[model samples]
Target: MKLKCVAIDDEPLALELVAKFISQTAFLELVSTFENAIEALSFLNQEEVHLVFLDIQMPDLSGMELARILDGKQGKFKPRIIFTTAYNHFAIEGYKVEALDYLLKPFSYEEFFKSATKAFQFFEEKENHLSANIASPSEYIFLKVEYQLIKILLKDIQVIEAYKDYVKVHLQGKTSPILSLTSLKNMEEMLPNDRFMRVHRSFIIGLDHIDAVVRNTVHIGDTVITVSENYKESFMDFLNKWIA
Candidate 1:
């Protein structure tokens, strides 16, 4: 995937050079160029930019200030920053904000390419890791309860119930359910659909652990869970496969 990029530098010549370098690069797509950091920030807020070539020192708003603001932002709009400046004094400050790379002023195309390659590889590795997680379903998952990450086997999970802001994981042979600080939706995603099904908005149950299904309710170890109207059809489909 191409890294959608934007160059922000107060110097007209510097901006033009960066824009030219971006145009020449195959993996980097130059979205727009801005001589003002404020305008760049506005554009970044509205668009999905993957990487940014930002100058550290500017008039109204500095690159460091902009980087900090972007860092504080939550969600997917957080773009990886690459500090481009003539001064070497800001190198320490640039890395403090977790910038991808620091490029000094009057950098040659070789230097620019090297920095851009770092961004490219960073994004490439990230995409591969996400793809791997989606393609390969794990047999177990980890849950954070308090300070520790507790490993829970998928087959051992009997029921997952939504409790306030947390989800209670009821495991087989366990007297008490493990309470985790996460939504039921997140729990659903972590579980394999073929083995676990959401019979209600508040509950996900393991199919193998179920004892019986009576009408709209599911029985597992004397605990009855009512199947919500929204999920009853899918639950019925699962039951029909075993009816013979």
Candidate 2:
């Protein structure tokens, strides 16, 4: 299905670049472009735009405010959002709004294409799994380790444990000692409830990766993750399947 897309940025150059990028993509259609947030919100109320390319720093109304207006009960369709900004400072806030991808400004075609492709894939995958209960996806993330920005698949992470300033990421076959910028609280929000459980405040364990769950610990492969008493009640409640 061809996705209906729109770009909203104050800068003409940024809008032009985004429009060019969208025009080249086979599965996307450029619906409209807007410099003001209020106009975009008005259009959103009437049209079925599948994806929106948004800019963060704007006058009068910021992209954050615009997103809030478009979200929840305000609109019938929830378009997947792709945030583009020059400043990297708002990444945490952008993810909090459940933005599919974040594009840093002054982006090269390669960088723009990469984020765009991710947005496309996220839309398609989200469409495919609309009926299935799943984890909050990990398509967007920052890892200070390898310097390669990490966009982990949520289901791939078997266990996550907080280190002093970093987090040890254990996936299906690979385990990474990642220098994480996000606190465990922020990480907790990014993980979906259906596939993950907070055994410990510092430990977010993937349920499918769990080998066993004893009283004191949860086992994922060879790693033994401890369960704190505070989180135990909620964890056990998560384990109860809603069988009809």
Candidate 2 structure, TM-score to reference: 0.56
Cα displacement (Å) at residue 160, model 2: 14
Residue 137 CA displacement from its true place in model 1, Å: 5.1
lDDT (C-alpha) at residue 193 in model 2:
74
Encode model 2's per-residue lDDT on 1-244: one tens digit a residue: 7889999998898889999999988888999999988888889888899889999899988898887666543434688788889999988776656677788878877887777777676666655554343454434444433212455677687877887545777778775545554457657777777777778878988888878767778887888978889997887776565221
- Tens-digit lDDT track of model 1 for 47-151: 999999999889999999999898767885589888899899987566556688899998999999999998897777667655766889666787756433566
Overall lDDT per candidate, in order of appearance: 0.88, 0.76
TM-score of each prediction: 0.57, 0.56
Which has the greatest TM-score? 1
Which residue runs does candidate 1 get wrong by more than 4 Å? 137-244
Segments of candidate 2 deviating more than 4 angstroms: 73-76, 131-244
